[model samples]
Target: QQQVKQSPQSLIVQKGGISIINCAYENTAFDYFPWYQQFPGKGPALLIAIRPDVSEKKEGRFTISFNKSAKQFSLHIMDSQPGDSATYFCASTASNTGKLIFGQGTTLQVKP
Candidate 1:
């Protein structure tokens, strides 16, 4: 109940295509859902996020679709690009805990 597991450890998507990645968590107490985008040798930055009160959130080319009942969430990169090629991580934390638990990570390669 304290972990988030992601799949496809790595992915290859064509430029201008849609890139999708999935993740699952066991803890129902997790209230804040945040997806992070990280470039090589850089710290993860908040790309987009949603709270249990909302079902989905979108920011520019990035979107997060969340399901509270299923304990699952996913990241969708619309019109992916070689420049968008990087690592994506889904993270969560309980309301009061400032610490976030992240998935293993998904390395997305958007080929030009």
Candidate 2:
């Protein structure tokens, strides 16, 4: 129930196009939702996050759409660029533990 599953192991987005990825979880106890962006051989960086209380959250060119009842969430990258061509991970955790359960990882390729 602590697992957060993400899909589309890979994606191709043209420059200036929107890149989308989906994730789902079975645990209702999870309250924190975070998305991480990673480049080759680099650590994941927190791009954006949202709490269960909010239906959506956005930061800069990144946005997260969440559905509490459906136990699902997604990340949308607007105006994608070559720099945005990296792996994206959707994660979640309960209130107590600081540990995050991550998705399988999505490789996004944005052509210039």
The number of the candidate with the highest TM-score is 2
Instruction: Please provide TM-scores, in order, for all candidate models, with all chains considered together.
Output: 0.95, 0.96
Question: Please, what are the lDDT tens digits per residue for candidate 1 over residues 1-112?
Answer: 8999997799999999999999899999999888888999999998888888888888898888999899999999999989998899998899778799999999999999
lDDT of 1 at 95: 75
Give me the candidate number with maximum lDDT: 2
Span of ten consecutive residues with least summed lDDT in model 1: 46-55
Model 2, 1-112: lDDT tens digits are 8888999999998999999999999999999999999999999998999998889898988999999999999999999989999999999999888799999999999999
Whole-model lDDT, model 2: 0.95
For model 2, the superposed segments whose C-alpha errors exceed 4 Å read none
Provide the global lDDT of candidate 1 against the true structure.
0.91
Candidate 1 residues lying further than 4 Å off, grouped into runs, are: none
